[model samples]
Structure formats: structure tokens, C-alpha cells
Target: MKTAKIHLILSCLFIFSILSCNQKKEQKIETTSISQPEMVLDLLDLQANNKLGKDTLVTIVNDPVYHKAKKYKAVSASLLVKTEIELNKIDSKNTKIVFECVDGYKPEMPLELFLNANPFLAFEDVDAPKGSKWEPILKEGNEMNAEPFYIVYPSISEKDSRYKWPYNLVKIYLEPLNKSTLELYPLKNKKLETGYTLFKNQCLTCHSINGIGGTMGPELNYPKSVTEYWKENELVNYIVNPASFRNKVKMPTLGITKQQSQEIVDYLKYMSENKKKI
Candidate 1:
């Protein structure tokens, strides 16, 4: 009788232990379920201000905070903005812009935070000029605002040697032609053909007018087809620093000084005028 009673006691203890273990497991699962909702909400909040979806998964992984939380460095992250546009192409009509984040970061942060509190909608009035030149209706009026604009997050990598932290942000503005502008070009009144020779010597190697030069870069004969988006100054700036516009571009600096660049521009203008005749 004592042996049977001891067996019953053992069975009861075993059942009790199993029940206790199951209860603990249920409690743990419930806690995890409750916390998961909060985590989802946090992720959604992080993605709120992303209008153009520029951020990437790689960017988030490289973040110091994320590395510390996950207890290890991330291998890679997905790129958010696959397509990129030149800075000059961004204007009032198409103000919403997306820049590919650095190689290993993710798009979990709000765009406003990434862009330093500048909204995309604010670009319309920020880059435009104040006064009208040659009547707003007759000429293409100032449509963009004058405020300095920048990429929300530019792509950066450890291998990059050119730009340091906080890449140089490009600013654009409009200026009207005045007496000073007219006076700067005294040679224009004297010899019209001087510009053409300079172009043939300097730019004829890579660039072609009406399908002439090597097919390395885009054809310059049709500036409208190449890019009607960029302003005059923007074009000049690109000619000055091709590296600033593209990452690791093959185009060399060409050592063309400012005066030479202007001469080339004049030659291009002459060519453009002649293109209408062709």
C-alpha cells in the first residue's frame, strides 16, 4: 500500500512540473507578442517622412546605434533609391527628390531628419528670383526658389577619397543680364570667329557637334535632347567640375580655366544658332 501511495505522489509531482513549465512558456510568448506591436509602430514612425524613399537598408546597418543594438556589424543593406538625377534637374515643378544613401545604411529614419529639416515643397519659392527680366510672360519666368538645396542623403563609402564628411552642397540662383554683363564680353563685339577655333582645338577630342567626335559621352549638338533641365550656370559648373556631378566619372578635369570655359560656351551658343539652319 505504501509503494502505491509513493507512486501516486511521484505522478502528481511530475504532472505539476509539466504544467508549470507550460505556463512559463505561455507567459514568455505573450510578452513577446505584446512587444512586437510596439516594435512595428516604431518602424512605421521611422518611415513616415520619406517622400522619395531615398534611404537604404545598408545605411541603417552601418549606423552606430543599430550596430550596438544588434550586437554585431551588418553584412549589407538594400538600396532604397535606385535612380539618381543631376542636382540641376531638381526644380520647383519636380521638387521631390531622392538620393541614394551611403552604401550600408537603411531607410528607417525620417527624411526630414535626414535632410536637416528642409521640406521638398519649400523648394518652389526658395530658388526663384525676385524681379522680372524682359517681362515674365515673354521669357521663361523664374519658377524655382533661391534657397540653397541639397541631397537628403548622398551615397558615400569608405573607399571614397574625394569628399569628406558633409559633402559640398551645391547652391543655384538666377541673375538678370545688365550693363555689367554686357560689358564683360567686349571681345564679342570684335571677333565672332575666335570662339569657334578655341572649341575645335580644346573640345573636339571627346565632344562632337552633329556626330563628329569619339562616342565617349553624350552628343552636344542637341543640348535640348541632352538635358533641357539644367540652367546656364549649372552647365558651366558641370564643365568646371565633372567630378562634382558624377561619382568617379571618367571625364578628366581637362585643365580648362574659367575664361576658356566661357569661350567654349560662346562657341556652343554659335553652334546652337547654326543648328536651326541645319
Candidate 2:
């Protein structure tokens, strides 16, 4: 009887240990599933100045290379920023505004373009065209329900690299343009100069040049630029499709063309060769 009793107690203890392990495993999965933080754009702060108009009927033109266009009743990005700036007591003369998406796509729109370009932020679709590709192209995964923040630049060409239409946007920040840092353009090549502009539009928000831009990304040209490390062809492929090289890369595709990628790469090479100019 004593032996039987001891065996029964041991079996119960073993079962308990197994259950405890399973429970811990479940908790571990749950903890890892949190993903990223919910992006918050304080509408209250933006509305304080009352410059942001109501949601007006606006159309969002999808990049023609990918999908057809979609329309939405959206808010004015310009007015929203105008109001926000006024409420926050910020001077727009010297500060640059940045829009950041969840997928590491951040673009710093020139204040002139931010005001004059007349971009809109579409929160809701107007009406889907029957059998259209609009809704089908909305981002998948964590951005599945990204609403109230689809960027639209109606004034610019669809092919323009000045800015990209980014959804799942999370934050907007202000930084100094630092024209003095960017004014030094020693290279006489017009193509590389245009490429530099493209880099400023698409990359300056994350990657710093000569230690003048943002720090979210690596320094493009200081002691050593990307040209020294990443091969030219590989760099081109990486820019066009980052996921092809690394499955878990944080950098999102900025929608640059093949030619544009080449130009940007050449510009980076120039910067690498002439680091003092930057």
C-alpha cells in the first residue's frame, strides 16, 4: 500500500510539471505576439487651432506602376500640419516635417512642398470600383487595418520620387532642414545632383549624410559610405527589393525606379569619394 501510494503521488507530480511547462510555453508565445506599439496621432493637438478643415472629398492616385487609383473623403495634410504647428508654437520657416510609416518608410517633405503640394490624408474610402485592385492592394499583416492615415499627394506626378504614398503611418516629426549642410554641391554633374535630391527626399529622414540628417539609419558618407561595403549591383537590387536580400530587413521599399536607383548609387559614390563636401 505504501509503495502504491508513493507511485500515485509521483505520477501526479510529473503531470503537474508537464502542465506547468505547457503553461509557460503558452505565456511565452503570448508575450512575443505583442509586435509593435499602436501608432498614435493626437487629433486633439492638431484640432486645437481649428485650421484643419473637415474631411472633404479627395481622390488618392495609386502608383500607376502597381494599381489603379482610389478615391476617399480625406483630411488635408497641409491644414492638419498648419494647425498642429500653430497649436504647438513651432516656426515652420526653419523646421522640416517628417512622416513615418510602420514599415520603416519615413520621408521628410520639404516645408515648401508640405504646404504648397496640397497632400491629403485619406481616412475612409469613397467607394470601391467594382472588381477594382484598390482594396486588394491595402497592406497585409500588421497593417491590415491601417486606417485614418493613408498619405496622398495629388499635386505631384505618380512617378515622382519626391514622396511615396505611405499607409500605416504612425508618427510625424519636425527637424531642421540645415540648408548650410546641404548647400555644398561640389559635383558639377546634374544627374548626380538630381540623385542627391532624390536621396534627400527618400533617404535623408533615416540615413544621415556627412552627419547632418537623421540617425535612424546608418551614416551614408562619413569615414565610409555604403559604397565601400555594399557592392553596386547588390546595392541596386537591395534598394529595389530589400526582402530579396534579407527576409527580415527593417527598411521598406521606397518605390524608386531602376534608373533612379542607379543615379542614387552614383550619387552615394560621389559622396563617398568627396566626404568633405557633404
Candidate 1 regions with alpha-carbon error over 4 angstroms: 1-192, 223-229, 276-278
Q: Pick the candidate with the highest lDDT.
A: 2
Model 1 lDDT-worst window of ten: 68-77
Candidate 2 lDDT over residue span 1-278, tens digit each = 99999999999999999999999999876554332221124543444555347878775566442256667767888777665454243445666666776655566656666677888876656664565323434432332434436777767777776665666565676655565245535356665777787787677767777876656677788888899999899998888888788866767788898889998898888877777544
Q: What is the C-alpha RMSD of each candidate to the true structure, in Å?
A: 22.6, 16.3
Best by TM-score: 2
* Residue 109 lDDT, candidate 1, scale 0-100: 24
Model 1, span 163-258: residue lDDT tens:
112111121111121211232232444354455555554554455566543234666765442334456666767777788898767566777776
lDDT of 1: 0.37
Question: Would you list the C-alpha lDDT of every candidate in the order shown?
Answer: 0.37, 0.66
